[model samples]
Target: MKTQVAIIGAGPAGMFLAHMLRTEGIDSVVLERRDRDYVEGRVRAGVLEQIAVDVMRKLGLADRLDREGLVHGGTNLSLDGEIFHIDMEKLTGGSTVTVYGQQEVMFDLFEAAGPRGVNIVWNADNVSLHGLDSDKPSVRWTEEGAQKELQCDFVVGCDGFHGVSRQSIPDTVLRNFERVYPFGWLGILADVPPCNDELIYANHERGFALASMRSPTRSRYYIQCALDDRLEDWSDDRVWDEVCLRLGPTAAAKVVRGPSFEKSIAPLRSFVAEPMRWGRLFLAGDAAHIVPPTGAKGLNLAVSDVTYLSEALVEHYRERSAAGLDNYSARALARVWKAERFSWWFTSITHRFPNMDGFDRRIQMAELDYIRGSENAQRVLAENYVGLPLD
Candidate 1:
């Protein structure tokens, strides 16, 4: 097969790119190692920054999102059981975030793919890139015991962190920065009403806890845990008990206990692979960078990455300009690093390190207290939390 672009991975980045390219009259194919069911069912963060919501609407994919997604004008932060609200909308001149699950976004994208003529190859195996440094690049993968090759002008790798996209870049050309947190988050999804209308990030002596939701009726909650914690180590009752204790009495009073349908432990990490573009092969989403879920920037970052990428590609095709393409890395990284800093800062103050001394605890408290008392501090938090404007 031959096309203008061969996009690897049918995840958000790739699929979003495909739809964007299609709307621009560019031809592309998306290759994925998993089937649609598996891809759409994966659990991911539910927060959508303004940029993401705008992208969805621009692509004509926000009908359901507009109807179902919860828009939050503010968020709550808690320090040792005391909660304070940050008026994000008012602070940022009406900017807000939408609580729409990634799963729902994928479903909308995939559902619209066929009618919109976005081509995708599911269950593709051993996907690999070739001739990335050349003007013409190609991708190859195995499908149902058969070999296939796609020749394209450019190949985009949105396959994520563990996928082959990042690995395809030579070691000499890539520089990595990473921080793997000592703890993980024990998250659960239950069929119960959320305790709060807006999301809450909590800091307690025990650890950090997040009270979130996928919908009005489906609550999602998480608490920091040991890296080695197991599913068997936490029962529904125990999880609820710990969540309530950490979130404190005021919020916990509204918590509704129910059987959790999904539970998992995810290690926290901040990672970034520099120089997103490698010749004709470009990387986006988790393939390029990763932020801890503390600030809910992972998917939104991917959206921004591809948003820049798609614009670059459009300029190359429409205006015959390579300036955007050439500057893509530097431009995207500028914003990526800012988000990295915010996520790191947010996590640092909210989570408990293994060796944290009294001074460290006091410092965290002081920082929270400052934000609580100062409108300037709250505005800074609100600005970062709702996401910075795209450059």
Candidate 2:
């Protein structure tokens, strides 16, 4: 097969980029190691930044999102039991975030791909890139024990951190920066209403807890846990008890306990692979960077990466310009680093570090106290939380 671009992994980043390119009359094929059911079933980010929402709408994919997404103008923060609100909408001049799950976003993208003619190869095995340094780059993979090759002008790695895309770049050309947190997030999805209309991030004496939702009736909750904590150690009742204790009186009073359908623990990390582009291969989404879910920037950052990438590809095809392509890495990294800083800062202030001393705890509290008391601090938080502009 031959195409203009070969996109690895059919996750949000690759699928969204495929759709964007399709709308531009650009031809591309998406290769996935898993089926659609697996990709769409992955439990992921539940918040949509303004940029993501805009991209979905721009691609004519936000009909369901617009109808079902919960629009939040502000978010709540708790320093121990004292809860405070940050008016994000007012602080950011009417910018707001939508509570739409990443799973739902994938559903919309996949559903539209067929009618829109976005080609995808599912269950591709041993996917690898070849000749990325040359103008005629190609991708190879095995499908059902059959060998297949795709000749394309360029290859894009959206296959995520563990995938072969980033590793395809030479070790001498790549530099990595990473921080793996000592703790993980023990989360549960239950069929009950959320304790709060807007998300509440709590920093308690015990640990950090987040009260979030996938929908009005489906509550998603999480609390910090040991890095090696086992799922068997946490029963529904015990998890609820810990969540309530950490959330404190006000928010916990509204908490509704129910049977949890999904439960898992995810470790936290901040990672970035520099020079997103190497020769004819480009990287986007989890393939290039990862942010702790604290600030909900992972998927949004991917949207921004593809947004820049699609633009660069469009310029190359439409205007015959290499300038945008040359500048893609620097442009995407500028935004990626800012988001990395925000997610890191937010996690630091909200999560308990294993080595934190008395002074560290006190400083964390002081930062939260300052944000609660100062409009300037709230504005800064709101600006980064809603997401910075593409410029």
Candidate 3:
């Protein structure tokens, strides 16, 4: 098969890239290792920055999101029984975030792209990319025991962190930077009402705990734990008790019980791969960089990449100019690094270190107190949380 662009991975980045390409009259095919059901059902990041929401609405994929997604103007940061509200609307000139799961966003994009004549290959396994430096780049894959090769003018690597796309680039041309945190977040989605009107990020002597929700009836919460911690070691009762302890008395009053569905531990880390492009192949989303979930920047960063990449691809194809494509690495990196800094800042302030003693705990509380007392600090948090302006 031949196409103008061959997209690896059917995640948000790849799917949104195909959707944007379709609008620009560009032909592309998306290949996914997993089936449609798996991709649509995976529960992950749930915060959409203003830029992400705007991009989806502009792409005509926000009908369901507009109807179902929850909008928030601010979030609360609680430390040592004190609360500080960072008003995003006030700081960003009316910009606010939408609380909608990444899975729902993928569902909308997948459905929108299907009827537009985009070719999506689900359950295509062991896909291999080759000849990126040659005149004809090709993708090889197997589906239902049938092996085939596809030739394309350009290839986009959006296959995520563990995918083959990142490794496809010659190791000689790549530089990697990574820092793993000492802790992980044990996230849980329960069928109870939310503990707060908006998201609450609490930092206490015990650890960090986040009070968030997926919907009016379904609450999502997380507590800091060891990176290797398992759900089997944390029963429902233990989870709730820890959540209550870390959140302190303010959140204790709002706690409720319900059927819990999803439970997983996510390690905190920051990862970036330099020059995001190799020959005719470009990397997007988790293929390029990764940030911890503390600042809710993961999904937003992925959306930003495809937004810029699709625009660059369209410009390159139409004007026969590689300027946009050539600058993709630098342009995307600016935002990526800013988000990396923000996520790290938030994580450091929220999570406890291994040797954190009473003195360290007091220092954290003082920092939190200063943040709550200072308008400039609140503005900084508000701006980063709502999102930096998309270039």
Candidate 4:
């Protein structure tokens, strides 16, 4: 098979890029190592930035999201037995975040692209790229125990951080920046309603806790734990108690606990790879960078990457210009670094360090107090939380 673009993943970034290219009359195909069910069922962030929401609407993919998503104007931060709200809508001149799952976004992308003949090959095996730096680049993969090949004008690696795309680049050319935190988040998804109207992030002497939701009736919650902590270590009741104690009186008063249906522990990390592009093989989303989930920038950053790549390819095919593609890496990396900074800062402030001394705790207390009291601090938090406007 031959195509203009070969996207190596069926996740939101790769799938959305294929749709965008299609609307521009560019031909592309999507390849996935996993089936659609696995891809769509994976739990991820539910927050959508305004730009991402707008893009979905532009693609005629916002009907379900608009009807089901919960729009939040603000979030609460709890510290020292006090919880304060940061009104993102008011601080950011009317911008707010929509609580729509990443899986839902994938569903919309799939539905929109299906009738239009978006060729996505699921369960492709041994997917690898060849001659990316040369014209007539090709991708090779195994399907149903048979070897297959695809020639393309470009190959995009949206397969994520553990994907083959980034590793395909030569070690000498790829520079990596990474920080693995000393702790992890033990998260649970329950059938109970969320305790608060908005998300609550709590920092107390015990640890950090978060009360979030996938919907009004389905709550997702998390508590910080040691890096070596196992899922078996936490019981449903114990998790709820820990969350309530850390969140304090105001936010915990509304608690509605139930048996947790799913539980997992995710280690926190901030990582970035310099130059998101190598030859005709471009990296997007988690394949290029990863941010700790504290600020909810992971999925949004990937969308912005698609936003940039889509425009670049459009300019290339329509105007016969390569300027956008040429500048893609620098542009994406600039935004990537800012998000990394925010996530790193937010994670540091919210999570308890094992080695934190009394002085460090005092400083954290003061910083929390100042952020709650100062409009400037609130604005900073709000702007980053709602997302910086996509460049």
Q: Whose lDDT is greatest here?
A: 2
List the candidates' TM-scores in order.
Answer: 0.99, 1.00, 0.98, 0.99
Clash list (residue pairs), candidate 3: none
* lDDT score of residue 369 within candidate 2: 95
| Predicted structure 3, TM vs. truth | 0.98
lDDT agreement of model 1 with the native: 0.95
Q: Residue-wise lDDT of candidate 1 within 110-162, one digit each (tens)?
A: 99999999999999999989999998789999999999999999999999999
Per-residue CA lDDT of model 3 for 11-55, tens digit only, reads: 988988898899999999999999999999988899999888888
RMSD (CA, angstroms), candidate 4 = 0.9
Candidate 2 per-residue lDDT, tens place, 175-280, comes to 9999999999999999999999999999999999999999999999999999889999999999999999999999999999999999999999999999999999
- Descending-TM-score candidate ranking: 2, 1, 4, 3
The window of 10 residues in a row where model 4 has the poorest summed lDDT is 108-117
- lDDT for each residue of candidate 4 in 22-73, tens digit (9 for 90 to 100): 8888999899999989998888888898988998898778999999999999
List candidate 3 stretches off by more than 4 Å.
none
Better of 2 and 4 by lDDT: 2
> Which residue window of length 10 is worst by lDDT in model 2?
78-87
Query: What C-alpha lDDT, on a 0 to 100 scale, does residue 41 get in candidate 1?
Result: 97
